[model samples]
Target chain A: MEKKKEMVKTKRAQKKDNKWTQNDKVFLYILIPILILFFVFNTLQLLKGFYYGLTNYKGYGDYSFVGLRNFIDLFSDARVGKSYVFTFKYAIVLTIIVNIISLILALGLNKEIKGKSVLRGIYFVPNILGGLVVGYIFSFIFTYILPAIGQMAGITFLQNSILASTKSAWIAIVIVGAWQGIAMNTIIYISGLQTVPEDVYEAGMIDGATGWEKFCKLTFPLILPFITINLVLCMKNALMVFDQIMSLTKGGPSQSTESISYLIYNNGMSGGQFGFQSANAFVFFVVIVIVSFLQMKFLGGKEEQL
Target chain B: MSENMEKVTKEAVEGAVTNENEGEAFAKKRRAKHKKQSGPVQGKTVNRVINILLALGCLTVLFPLYMTTIIAFKQPSEMTNDISGALGFPAEWKFENFTEAMRVTDFWHSLGNSILITGVTVALCILIHSLAGYVIGRKMIKLKAFKMSYYYIVSGMFVPFAVLMMPLVKQTAQIGIANRFGVIVLYTVFFMPMNVMLYTGYLKNIPTQLEEAAHVDGATAWQTFWKIIFFNMKPMHATVAILTAMSTWNDVMTPLVIMAGTDENTLPLAQLNFQSQFGTNYNLAFASYLLALLPILIFYIVCQKQILSGVVNGAVK
Candidate 1:
């Protein structure tokens, strides 16, 4: 009887061990294919960008590498230079204004109020809509309402075509950008505000700190982490501003609003300057990385914190 | 007991030591308590004022939308003129503009194309993202050890659509799916970073033992994941579904680039087509814009909670 029991136990253990090995093999086999595909696709895309950047391949036949000529052309191109400046300015201004407005709005809405959630939802609805839709909607405002307001108020400040003037076009674009973007910033700020312990605020209140003092001392410091994140996102998203610019102005009124992304789109898809466009794209990618990295480093402080 | 008596005696001494200090502390406490009592009442009044102010502010936000919607129904003369009419509720509700807009553009055909493209993209996105997330989440994959692997996939997020447009268009044409399902799949891949982040974040909170128990009960890895893990991801699935659906549904740029060779335009592209076709008819153009926005508006109104919930959940992290 003892010998029979030992045999059965050995058989059961062997079956379980076999299953474990099989499961390991399955995992190994499946993972290999996924990893290969992921690596191959990503590398191909990156390599294609680099390879195309080096060659003057204008969407045609065999091409040879023209070392740094495209970069030279990029520098000399007046539109590219102006666009670089314009995009940078727009991004900086938008990031600052949007972050400030959102932080204020978040604080305002965070107060004790009924239907606050519903109001927040209403505010956020525009964000869910496409950038193009928002742009299209604003186009009507700039073209119609602004002119009407100018007529009613007897001021030619905005005029019929706000985007026609270089000075005002960038401002209009940034305002529209900020308006569309406030929801994301507000949400992030609210999330950050939630992390601040309630006792901290209570302590501040007991200390007889004024609202402004409380904001500058307690709220801003506590929300610095979120501030960094919101700034980074705002910068990146603004730098890549495309659809809104497209529907709103199409980088128009003598190309004052021509963002880098729009310029790339025009050169590559519209102009058929694939190689030059690829180089521009590479430069844009580098700039974005450096700017984002510098911002993160400055704000993140310690490496471990990031 | 001695400690209690000593604390009482200390309080008594404090009360008697400085009448001024006691009076101030007592008065301040009373004031604070009173303020706390009336805080909600005052808060409501302030909120009411704020709400009205915010509503006025929101009118500024909604003015353009209102103008567009109203003028779409109004005559061209009415639209071009500063007529004294409220932005909402035109004096005469005209249904003819809808039909006129439909006729001016190939609205039905374009709508069909948009729906097909969006549907295919969403389906492909859900499939690939879920499959990839499941394997990475549950399986002890070797390359998963290389932490950079996930980053490599996610790094595609920041590669702007413009950068990829030239190469993607060329590749899609070369592969002969530029205007077909290939475009859809590539679109799915283009925006997969957020999905991956969401799923990974979500999966981290789930226990691996559930799948392990299933595997122990004689199920394949895929089966175990499909039955146990994926089923449990209802909220995440709902959020991703709505988000990706909204994204693909409203996308204009991708279809514009890929579908340029053909009249296989989406609703947004169709609106552009309508604008060019009826350049003089601003009313028709605005009507076409309204038509394109109608389905999305309806969807948003119906699924407000889902849409808002998705935004809050995906964004807060």
Candidate 2:
């Protein structure tokens, strides 16, 4: 009779297992379709895109396996090289200017001041705008208003559209970029400021630390993680600047402001070199991946050390 | 003897109370000292200068947007002289500039397309991502292979759309969805991973006890998800919705590539074409920019509080 009872218990456990299997089945049926869709569109396409980098073709149709030929062409292509160089310069300048201005704004606004809330909203307005609109608006400013203002003030540098020249084009891009980018970074800095506890400041004061010393020792370390996050975000954005460049400068005055992203889009879609552009995209992606990895590692280590 | 003992005890209690008050006062004085040490030290002139500088910075930031507004309203003849300062209202305001912009862009049709595409994409993206997030965060954690897929999707965040544009264009065309609807599919596909990251991150923190209970009540998985889990994800829902909506509304490249030969055009694309077609007509171009900008501004104004709080909360965590 005891053996019979043991067998019966095993049967009941098996039945419970069967029930869970039934639920798993239902779950799989629900999930599989979405999974398939995601796979086919994103994962599958990503692999296929990488494959095109190894071949030679126009924007469509059959291609021969070229085996690093297109990748070789990427290094030799001066236009692509110029875009990469320009984008890097833009990113470095933007990251510094944006972080500084936003941090200053955060410091100023973090004080016990009146109208701080309203001022924050007003400051954040540019971020609410799409890049295209902001770009176009800034384009008009550069192409017309600034020139007119320059004429009025007798300033030689601003007599023509800054975007019309290679030297000034980058400066224009940086300005427009910072104009919009500062809002998000400022908000981020404010949030970061909020996280650094008030007691720490009191401690700094107790140590008789100067304002600059207190900031360097206390606030900066506390907000290091935020800086890292913002830096990475800023770098990525600066690197991928397409809309503003397209609208404001159109990568003009000799393709001086053409970013890698713009280069990929132009070459792949409109420039009629499918495999070559694909190779450019792959390299671009690899560079992005490496920089992103470095960013996380470099800052993540600092954050942990802090 | 009893009276003397009572008086001594009362005196002791009073002494303790006085000591405690003294200690509290000392702590308050210390706090005040810290404040006095760290508080602002700028003289009146310095303070005034800083405030003036900040105000000036605000004006400088506002310059381009201000120009867009004034230039949009000014007649063509006024453009040259009115460029002196960016702030003044036009003497002859061209309200018809908006009408002209609207006519040039085929505003109503493009607006309809944008609304349909963005709305449907946002809704579908939310549903699919939330469901996927729920499953991954809750159920799939136990299965190693399934957990790997979770990581895979998360890794997709690093790859920009430009990387896959080559194959993606062909793939969409192969399926014969290379138009307005195709653009929607791309948004849904590309925008999924971020929202999934968000939702899954959120759902991981939400305990499964309630869901388990719903399961115990003989509710099917579908019923339990709809009745209990989906409603509980309101904050994630809002973040995903607003983000997806904004990007879809503002997007130009995706539509430009997929629907280049097609008749369909979203507002941003329409605006771009309008600007080009009316090239050098600053008034109409400025007006077109404002018109493209108007809906977003209204959306911001309407949902300002929620958007701000939601964005801050979402990113902060």
Candidate 3:
């Protein structure tokens, strides 16, 4: 009798599980709408972007499909090449500068200091301001204030506007980018520092570890994950640089500062090279994917080793 | 009574002896040892040096803002070509610059547009993404379909917005939504991958037993989610709201493309459009920039604690 009852209970449970439940209804109710919107907005657009790359369709009128010609053209185009070179260079430099400054700021702020929160708030102010506005503000400084100071101090380099020169224009962008970029990165690092337990520092002290030694041995290893996060975030943001370039240089000084995104927006959308820029955008996408994948593999390996 | 009084006095004496011998002496020794150990790490000199460095850092960060404020108050005539003209306070405060800036940018209209866009985008992101996250988070463990869907959604994170820019413009125009409405929808969609990841990760810590209990008590899945699970995800909501709001508020590209040729303009868009018109009129331009910055700056100031913590939480996850 006991065996029969157990078998019957199992059969009932299986029946209930197989039957459509209210949970499934709720799940579909939520999932279907999101999937629909996702399809219409994201997935569909991506596929269309890929298709647009193969054609010579301008923004307005239709045109014949250009096949692999656009993609082929991307190889020999000097402007495209220049942009890629500029973008990669900017991304690398900005990433390094931002990480270093933010890390140092984080370390200092993590100490017991008066008005720590207030100081942090001040630093983070730039991050909250719109990029365009910040760009405009800094543009004025680069144009007016810096030059004035330069003239007053009799510094030849400072007397002229940096944005007007191709060689120094990119550096100005990096400075502004780093100024805003450091804020969030610093906050991330501080949080990482907070995660290192007091006991670990105590143990380090007991073992006669110096301040630098403790940071290197104890704090750095514990915060490796945060470093990876910051690095990846910083790299991705740097590569897609747009707004500051727009307001500051307009990709001018002979298009020396045209990032990949800026190029796409300028040429593809407004400049009526939609199909060609689409191909460029597609290539840019693949580059981002490969770069991100490599970063993950490299950084993820380091994280594991630590 | 005399016997009881004598016993109490003896116990008090014993307590005092134990406190002095064990507690006070040990505390003093530990305090001294702590000071000795922390001397190098937390020395007065080291702290003072760090503080001085930090103060300098703050000044550097504030320098541009200070310049902007001073320049905005100075007249075009007072804005001489020299450093003193740039650095010194305006001879007389020119509050008219702000009025001119407001008039030029249609400041109130664009401000409203920005607030509306940000508010709606944040609300929709929280609502749709959290529900999607909860469902995926709960069911992905048992269902293969849910797991695949989760991956499908999360993969959007790696795709850069530039790749989608041109195509999205054409698509939105085709769909007849290439306006502020379209921008809001796109913002919600753009933020989904990161927000969903955050939400699903948060949901893992919420115990399944609560849902099971609700099920046993004859509550429907909808009721269970709304009543129990939704409220449990407040911190994650704050994280999503803050991250989405910041990006949406400060964003320029989406509004620029989507709302092109429309009468509507977000704050950033207005500033960009009027930039050339305000060219060389540093006072008006600076005033306009400050006006554009004020809303988000004030928001940040009021919610600094939550905003900072929210960013940390979102980034770490």
Q: What does candidate 3's lDDT look like per residue over B101-188, in tens digits?
A: 9999999999999999999999999988999899999888777778898999998998888899999998889889999999999998
lDDT of 1: 0.72
Chain B TM-score of candidate number 2: 0.82
lDDT of each: 0.72, 0.79, 0.86
**What TM-score does structure 3 among the candidates reach?**
0.91
Model 1 steric clash pairs:
none
Candidate by candidate, in order, the iRMS in Å equals 3.6, 3.7, 2.6
Best by TM-score: 3
Ranking by DockQ: 3, 2, 1
Off by over 4 Å in 3: A1-22, A304-306, B1-42
- For residues B1-317, write the lDDT of model 2, one tens digit per residue: 22332343344345455655645655665577667743444322234344444544666555566667777887877765446534456786557998988898888888899899999999999889998888777656555545776887878777888888888888888889998788888899888888888888899667776765666567998888888999999888998888788778888888888888787778888877876778688888888888888787778868877766666655655
Show model 1 residue runs off by greater than 4 Å. Answer: A1-25, A31-42, A195-197, A302-306, B1-44, B83-89, B139-146
Task: Report clash pairs, candidate 2.
Answer: none
Error of 2 at B250 (Å): 1.3
Residue A133 displacement (Å), model 3: 0.6
Q: Is the docking of candidate 2 incorrect, acceptable, medium or high quality?
A: acceptable
What is the two-chain DockQ of model 2?
Answer: 0.38
For residue B301, give model 2's deviation from the true position in Å. 1.3
User: lDDT score of model 2?
Assistant: 0.79
Model 2, residue B191: C-alpha shift (Å): 1.4
DockQ of 3: 0.54
